[model samples]
Target chain A: MNRRRHTIPTLALKELRDGIRNRWIAATIILLGTLALVLSFLGSAPSGELKVAALEVSVVSLTSLSMYLIPLIALMLAFDALVGEFENGTMLLLLTYPVRRWQIIAGKFVGHSTIMLLAILIGYGTTMAVLIFTNDGDTSGWQAYLAMMASSLLLGCAFLTVGYLISSLVRERSVATGLAVATWLLLVVFYDLGLLSALMLDEGKYISEGLFTTLMLANPADAYRLFNFTGITEVANLVGASEIKVGLAAPLLSMLLWIVVPFLLAVIRFQKREV
Target chain B: MNSTPTIELKAVSKRYDKLTVVDGIDLQINKGESFVLVGHNGAGKTTIMKLMLGLTQASSGQVLVMGENPANKSFSARRGMLGYLPESVSFYHHMTGLELLNYYASLKGVAKTEVSSCLEQVNLSASAGKRVNTYSKGMRQRLGLAQAILGKPELLFLDEPTTGLDPSLRRDFYQIISDLRAAGATVVISSHSLSEIETQADRIALIRSGKLVACGSLDALSEQAGLPVHTRLAVATGHTGRVAAQLEPHFEIQKITDHSVDLVCPVNKKISLLRQVADLGEVVLDINMNAPRLNEIYLHFMNGEKA
Candidate 1:
């Protein structure tokens, strides 16, 4: 067997193990799991021909909920990365070792990301399991449901990168926590409201389809929403969901771009950080 | 006096805006020599250590450990040579002592097979699996010490190594330091406790307000202070006045009391002076001879010289 022996994976495993042992992580996982279950059961809709089944609807809604929740968890995990060491005074001891600073950052990122991924898998996986068992392997929603699950993992990666960026930039854990919460509110909730208000005030003519596409491309949350509702919504399907006026790529590609840019920027900043 | 200088600072100076933390200190710590740096608060002792370890950048001059800059990103050779104990040894509270050691051991590239024995060395074998948060202050210090010696690092930097330790533990700590020195590990210890470090350090350096005020062996520094080694004489009768008058012209008499007299003179002249003082009068009580300690030398430079 060819094991790559990646530093990130090793660190991620270590972090996951540590998290599993911690009561905070266990409690958070339970809370998120309960939230996933409630969101799934409460949000499901009746099925129709060519429409996603109740289980798939539940899975999709749960995936959207995860888009917001996973990032918060990631930030909570990483905000104190450097600052915690400074408070605890362990950074000096670590810095004296032969390991490079980038490795430390990368390793920690991977570890926390793995934990987030595990949480998502466990939480959403349980929701899916309940849906499948309740419906008795109803086959209608499985494909689309799997796609949503995959997208949620990608979204978790995106949020994990953001958390690392916050950790790297801030010197105090308390400040980082506040900033992370504020950023979550802004990017996940208020950002969409702001975009919607802007579009409404500008009217349909001035905003244009290209401007709407470009705006959606700028924010990960919007891009994720666009991907989640791509051809599913009656209004979007009627407005010609297949057209790509903002270049040749679809909204999914725009979402992928959102994932790549911030991730790369975080890695760049992490590589240059001095312990 | 060893073959190699484990830590070499060439014209190194570290400044924070208008204030200099470490000022142009050119120092070399020889291999296998327990070098002690003694100074008070803001004396730049910690700054020098930070500069050597590349924790802080020097404003000017060069720092080389084993002929390489520790600041360079790719300078693994220099970094691998060092095992450092920070002033306040804080660790990951969530991790057990063994886990923390294993984590550090892996970072230092120490093979897993040797970790158990390394744990044993610090007397942490019994509680190695316990979380560090539960460990006492002395236990944490010992854990920190264990990590420092994990790979048998060729160079070690210990800042206040015995701060929270008990007396017996402190003795054990020095014994380990001495063994490290004997086994060819150069150790640099920075501390405010001159009494404890007096016997441990083969060479001592004094820093005052970011500048190297004095650097040498105890005997050499004592000579540099130029403060006379004190000799106290106690007389039975009223010869205190007469003896003071008799010896006043010949030597610089520091103090003359009713029953006793104290004088500062050369270490070489102590025997002859004692003989002369005894001959002049009936020496009823006792006489004590003492050399100037490092604390007095440090105070002399701190108060008398500009940093």
Candidate 2:
């Protein structure tokens, strides 16, 4: 009983230490920070023209950027979480330890999420800090900006969970890599592209407003988008998003579901998986 | 009453789809016994180990390790009491040996102090601070042995542990196994090359094509195999002719010299033949008995099955 408590933390800490050693944390921070700073510097001009807070305009740009970057990084970080262990032959020894399969999933999630959290903090935090230092005393957009940053993390975790599911479903790392890239193309790129095509082709004929609303939330990246964009009307208008049919809780709840559902499925798949 | 076995597989069979990997294996590994499982590649030796570890579930029948069903989803406290070294052991390459052992120690609920002792036992203490990526194959194997011996586990599984080890390293590996056995740890080893470990096994199970074809101690299997045991006798100069005359009637003479005679007899016939030879004690200068090897017994079994 006493040993079980430390199992997840032990595993999580190992992954955290691995990330630090591999310089993944540093790479993620640098990538996110450089991109956020560049967007913040160039994004304020639209804020002046559109009469929106500079931070809010930057949130719009970051949310769009996150749709591509967060999921890609999340998938890359964890696509082989289980498969790599199997490939390396470490999974056999890991299973011999006194740990349930779900704990493995939970521990990996916590560790990977920590890495993503750090990246978001140092990266997005830099932009928020610069905006505050240079701006008038209006702190109105900071709330949406924080929510966007948090939602970006939620988005990353959702993809991380999806990557775990991919890892659980396959035997080879090459297959996992291919499936992960396909997942990014589908969820981050093709999902929105398909939606746009559906909207263009449907033109309000076959797809209902509520159905369109649900479809947007069905994709986790868009759900994150709706969270950051819909809360601020000025940012929503700047991004040209149509009026959201659902309340704020809808996107948040959907994002939570995105994290929970795939994670549970991964655990189930992993439990039945033979080492 | 028989004590509960450390591991028991009752009619256990594992199949992946239409292919059966382990077929109705019924085995009992007693507490504190050193057991070896030997078979050719893809002969289901590793599958049996995996079944015992509950790394993969058996398709049919029951497996009990340390008196608990290892496949049970409820947390297994016994897992902390069990250790395994896979065929090709791998560690987190980024971690130092000390860190990796400490990680396992924490999971096994062992004191952190045991980590160093385990490293020392495997002769890895000098490089404990070095990352696994820098360690040589032999060093990594020793490190794996170090990990498997952690917590002084009640049960330890080593799969093909000496595949790439040097002879001296192999001797070191078995020395640790003997130490663990002295400390009452039940060790199960799966290997294709059982000849090297033949002397170390308390009992060995020979698996062929997913079925346990034969299992017993070397002598017992040799008996069951009906392989001949060789006996050599040095006779007094003039007694060799008398011995050959009497023993040739009951034994097959392998060789004959002026003062020495070598006789080969069936396992069952050996005792009686030896008794007859002992009657001529004064005439016989020395008597030597050589039992058949595990590999020969294996070949006999394989040939018999083939026939």
Candidate 3:
């Protein structure tokens, strides 16, 4: 039992080490940091009191950047987990250990999650700290700042789970890479478009409220939007009427479901695979 | 012969669809035994190793390492009982050799401090700090051996262990296998080099077309194959035709180009045959009794159903 407990953490540490050394990881971090910096300069609101506060200006700017950048970083870090190992022939070595397959998957998930969380924490963390320092401690934007971090983590966990699922489903790394990128495009971009078309075709009567509510809960990105837009004024209204009722309960449950379902499927497939 | 079987396969078989890769076969390898399995390509040698390590499941029958099924989720009890060196040994390219060994050792429940000594045993101590991707094939094969020997497993399964090794290094690897046998670890390996393995393996198991065609000690296999142990004789004069006719019924004369004639005689008939051949001609040429090489025995069985 002690050996089993150690498997997750040990494998997790290995994942962390591998992630830190990966050039893809370094490149992702730098690209996301640059995007954050660029968005800070472009996306800030001009009419608000935050105009004078460069830090609040940056935080507000990062709100849009974090949504896209965090998921992108998370996807890049995790999409190749099992498929990459399969290609490298190390998965066979890993399976020879006494650990269970689910434990291995969980360990990898945890490890990738840690790297994602740390990246978001550092990149957004630097921007937030800069905001607070430059804004003279106006701290009204602090709650939104922390909420954005939490949303980033929630979104990251969702994508990492998606990545593991892709790795499990596709044996070839090239195929896995293609499918993973397509999944990202669908979920982050096309999913909302599909939902919008469905809402329009429904004429806002039947599917608009209930289906939109379910869709918001179904797509993890929408769940992140729920958390970020719940307390805010303008963005909350623009999301749709059903999103107004999305509270801590629905989004949290949805995020938890996102983490559990795909990960559980990955573990199940990993257990049966010949490694 | 040792009594306890460190590794056992009971009517084990693996199949993919209609094709059987490893047919129903039973192999019992005792503790401290150095057993080598030899075969051609697609002869199910590596498949057996993978089944032994629980990296793959047998379509039927049981494979046990140290009396427990390797695929059991509660396999921690037997975790360090066996070490496996896969065919193409590739590790985390980012980790140094020491780190890779340390990681594997930690999983096998070895003390972290003893990792250095494990590396030393395989002569990889100096290269321990280098990344795995930087290591040559011979170096990687050494590292693979190092990892396999780390926890002092009761059984070791090596697949084509000397693939990238030179002749001297292959001798070194055999020496290491001998050392493992002396230390009471059962070593099982599969390779194509039968001549070298003839000295290394306590017993050889021959697999052809996924079936166990032959298996036994070298002498035992020779006896089973009914291969006449031959003696090469080089006589002093033109007695070639006379000696060839004299030994025709009892022995096979392979060549008589010069004064030398090579005749193969049954082990039991060699002494009398040598004397008769000597009396027929001047005994200037010496006699050398040749035990049938494993390669010959391998071809004999591989060609037909003799043994």
Candidate 4:
């Protein structure tokens, strides 16, 4: 029993080691940091006389960047996590151990969540550090910035779970990759596009305010957006949704549900998967 | 051998959707016994191993390891009692050999300190710090064996453990298996090409198309196939005719030369016939007996099944 409990940390540590050895963590940090720095510099160019604080503008731009990038990178990290093991013939050996399949899922999810979290910290943290040092704005803008970083990790967890589901459901690595990409397109890109088209078509006629909020929160990416952008005056004004009424509960809970439902399904599917 | 079986499959079968990969298989491997499962690729050897290891659930019937249903969630292979080496053994390419083995050792609840010793046992100590991607195929296989033997598992499952190994390394691999067997671990090995294992396996199960065609010790299996034990007799300068005359009544001549004759006799009768040839005294100067090979026995049964 003690050994069984120890299995997840053992496995998670190995996965983290793999990430470090392959330079995955380093590359992701550099990628995020560089992009965040670039967005901070150029994001204020189109303020159009609003003269909002630079850090607030950075939050708006970074949120948009993370909405597309975090989920995509999370999917990229996870598309091959299980299927690749099967292809490599390592899953068979791994299953012969005393660990359960759900432990494997738990361990990998924890490892990937940590990786994404680190990327967010060092990547956005650099920008945050620069903003503080430059006295770009008072510490008031730090709240939304910190919230965006936290919610970005949550969004990453949601997609990571979805990626595990895709990996567990498919047999071929190529199929997993294709399915992961297709899911990202459906959620991150097309969901918003489809929602925009509907709102334009409705023009405040058919889609009610509550329905619009539900629609936005249903997709994890939009949930992340609402969680980051809601209740922030500068960003809310920028996206032109000042009248939006939402507590911290709905989108946050929806984001967590996005993480959990697919995670549970992935565990179920992986439990029955033959190595 | 211990009376209790380390692994028992009673009419166990596994089906993947529309395909049946493992037919009803009933087998009992006694504790400390070394059993080999030999067949062509896709003939269900690996599937049977998977079933025993609880990597796959049997679609029908029962599979018990150490008297516990292996597929049950409560069954813990990590109590430091079970080990497995999969075919074409692969590792995280970015990890050093020591790192990979250490990870498995930790997963199997083995002491982390024993990792280097395990690598040394497989002659991988020198390369322990090198990444797996840089290791050769044989090196990877050695690393696999190293991890499989950690904790000195009581039951070890090896799927084609010796593939990609040279002749000397194959001999070393079997030596390690023999040592494990001597240590009272029930070992199950699966291989498609099995000639080198003739003397290593205490018993061999011949599988064909998800079915056990024949199983037993090599001598028993070949006898069941009705393969003959071949003997060659070389005579003195002028005794060939006399030796052939005496041996002709007892056996079929596979070949007859001026000075020697090859006789094909039933395995059970080979010893007696050789005694009889000795009884003939100086007529035969030399005698050579050939045991039927595993491949021959395998072909005989595979063809019989096809027919």
Candidate 5:
């Protein structure tokens, strides 16, 4: 029992070590940090002399960036996690160990999640520090920034789970990569466009406000956007969330669902997988 | 200490959709036995190993390891005492050898301090700090062996262990296997290198197309094959023809050269052949008797199966 308890952490630490050695963690940190820095600095520039809220504008732009970048990065990190090991023959060696199948999934989840969280923190945290030092935004703007960072992490987790599901479903890493990219395209880029077109074609008759709200919360990226942009008053006013009828809890709960359901499905798939 | 077999397969069969990989086969390997499984390509040697390791479930029948159904989730306890070296051993190329060993040790619930010693045992201590990608094929194989022997597992499964090793390294590898067996560990190795394993294996199992063709010690297999032992008589410079003429009527001459004549005698008839060669004492400069080798027995069985 004690041995099983240690297996997950041990495997997680090994994954982290491999990530560090492969420079994936460093690359993610640098990628996220550079992008966040550019968006924060450029977005705050116009509001400088106009006396507009610099932090609020920066939050909106960063939230938009997170919507596209975080999920992509998370998927890239995790799409190959399970299938790559199988391709490399490590999965056979790993399975021969005393660890359970769920432990493998859980350990990878913990490791990839840690890497994503670190990237988000260092990337956005540096921007937050700079903004706080440069301008005295209201406490509400700071709170919105914090909420955006948290939701970005959650968004990454949700996609990471999706990547694991793709990894477990496929036999080859190349197939997993293709499926992951398609998943990203479907969820982040095309889903909302398709939804908008459907709504436009409906002429406001069939697609009600409540259904729209549910549809928005259905996609994790949209859920993340609503939570970060609409959950905070300062950023919510800027993004015009007055028409969004759903309470704050719906998006949050849906985001949590996005993380849990896919992850559970991944665990189930991994459990029965032959490798 | 108990008399239970370390591994047992009862009518075990494995199939991949329409293709049957392992046919119905029953086997039992007892504690501390040094067993070797020999077969040609696509002979299901690896499938048997996977079945014993519980990496793949059997399509029907049962596979028991350490007296537990290895297919069950609860069989993880048996895995702690099991060590496996896959056919094409691979590792995280980014990790140093020591780091990889340490990770496996942690997974096996062994002490972290044993990592260095394990590396030393495989003669990889000098390269322990180097990343796996920097190591040669033999080094990577050594690292694989190091991981397999880390916890001094009670049951070790090695698939083609000497695949890429040089002759000396292969000798060193079998030396390690011998030492492990001496420590009362059950060692099961599968290899196509028949002559090499012939010396170290206490018992051998020959598989052909997922079926067990023959199983026993070397001498038992030789007896079962009914192969002949060869006798070569080296005569004085001009006596080769004379010796061949003298032996041709009573013995079958397999080959003849300027200086020698070779005769094949069944295992039971070796002594009579030797006595007859002794009668031609002065003409025969020297006489040598050679027993049937493992290669011949293996070929006999493989061809017998084909027939």
Candidate 6:
């Protein structure tokens, strides 16, 4: 058991080293940082010369940005994690080592999660730091900003875990990539549009308020948007939080479920795979 | 290194849907022996290797490595004692050869200091600092060999180890295999280059159409095939016809050229046939004997199977 524990760290270190050498870490940081900088600075321009705090306005835009960007980046980073290794023939060599199959998956998850966390910190963290330093904002505003950042990380983890599931379920990298893109489109784009259309067509008859909330929680992206936009009072007020029927804990728990359930399913599939 | 068998497959078979890749076959490789597996393409060679490595499960029968069922996850401990060089060796292209070796070394629980020496053993020391993508095919093969030998595994499986290697490098490869054998390591090699392994293999297994056609030592296989040695005697300028007539009654003449007559005789009758040829005096100018080679024995068995 102790030996198995050591294998995960070693494999994770190798994954990190590969990422660093290939400039993936640097690329991710630059992409996220530049976008966050653009969104934060431009987003605050609309609330200029108003009584509303600048940081609160930035948090609202950044939450929307995080809702779309974080999940996409997370999926891109991990969609090829398992199938790529198999296609490159490294999985066969790695499996021949003393490590167990679960260790391989766990190590990859740790490595990829760490990369995502680091990117979020440097990108969004830098924007928030600048905002906090430049303007004296209320304590609630800062607290809300921190919560948004944390939940954004959770949302990224959710998509990354889903990416792993796609990777383990497919035999080829191309198929995995296709599935990943389709998954992103479904959750990030079509799911919300489909839900809105259903609500509009129902006229509040069959799609009750309770069913609407359940449908929102069904998609991790929707849960993430609700958690960041409506969970906090300051940001929620800016994004019209009065209409939200579900509580904060439900969306948060669903996010946690998104991370665990897909991860467990991936492990089971990878364990039984012929490779 | 002991007398016990390092690997055993009993009535083992592997199938993919309707296609049976490895038919019911039994094989045992004892410790410290250099065993070679030779077969044509799609002859279940790689499938059998996968079975032994526990990369896949057998459809029926048993596969035991170091007295443990490799398919069971609990037997992963035995994997540490085994090394494999796949037919197509691939590495993280961005990593340097040294880094790749170090990565595998860590996975195998080997000392970091041993990485450099393993590179040296495969004649890859000069290119150790270069990234794997920059290396040539032969260089990559050497790096593959380096990684396989890194922990000095008790049992090593090399599939087409010498593919893409130059002649001298092939010699170097066999030299390493010999040294490993000297150190009492069981080595299993699967290759298409029969001449290279003919002198090195302690035992050989031939498979065809997903079945074991024959398995034995070189001499044993040759004897079982019962192929005869050919003797060619060069006759004097115009004595070819006369020599052919003289040898026709006593021996089976394989061919009669202008200057020589070829005769096929069993191993036991070789010496007497030579004497009979000498009695022809100046009719014979020079003599040459061609012993049966592994290629011939292999083809004989393969063709015999078809018949």
Best by TM-score: 2
Summarize candidate 3's per-residue lDDT along B47-74 as a digit string, tens digits. Answer: 9888888878899999987777787767
Give per-residue lDDT, candidate 2, residue B13. Answer: 97
Sorting all predicted structures by lDDT, with the top scorer first, yields: 2, 5, 4, 6, 3, 1
List model 2 lDDT by residue over B81-126, tens digit each. 7889999999989899999999989878888988999999999999
Ranking of candidates on TM-score, top first: 2, 5, 4, 6, 3, 1
Model 4, B256: alpha-carbon shift in Å? 7.7
**Better by DockQ, candidate 5 or 2:** 2
**DockQ scores of all models, one per candidate:** 0.34, 0.65, 0.35, 0.48, 0.52, 0.42
On lDDT, the stronger of 2 and 6 is: 2
lDDT of 4 by residue, B22-57 (tens): 999999999888899999899999889989988788
- Candidate 4 lDDT over residue span A201-254, tens digit each: 989999988998999989999999887777566677767766786766888999
Return the TM-score for each candidate structure: 0.86, 0.95, 0.88, 0.90, 0.90, 0.89
Q: Which residue pairs in candidate 3 have backbone atoms (N, alpha carbon, C) closer than 3 angstroms, thus clashing?
A: A55-A131, B234-B285
Report the Cα interface RMSD of each model, rounded to 1 decimal: 4.3, 1.8, 2.6, 2.5, 1.9, 2.4
lDDT of 5 by residue, A1-275 (tens): 23433888887887777788779889988888888888888887877775657667878999899999999999998998899999999999999998898888889988888988889898888888878777864433777778888889999999999999999999999999999999999999999999999999999999988888889999999998888778777677777875565657888898899999988999898888875
When summed lDDT is taken over every stretch of 10 residues in candidate 5 chain B, the lowest stretch is B265-274
Model 2 lDDT at residue A197: 96
* Cα distance off (Å), candidate 6, residue A187: 0.7
Please give the range of 10 consecutive residues that has the lowest summed lDDT in model 6 chain A: A1-10
Indicate the worst ten consecutive residues by lDDT in candidate 1 chain B. Answer: B72-81
- Of candidate 6 chain B, the 10-residue stretch with the lowest lDDT total is B265-274
Candidate 6 per-residue C-alpha lDDT over B25-102 given as tens digits, one digit per residue, 9 for 90 to 100: 899999988888889989999999999999999999999998888888997777777889999998989899999998
Better of 1 and 3 by DockQ: 3
Cα RMSD to native, each candidate? 4.7, 2.1, 4.0, 3.2, 3.7, 4.1
At residue B184, what lDDT does model 3 achieve? 82
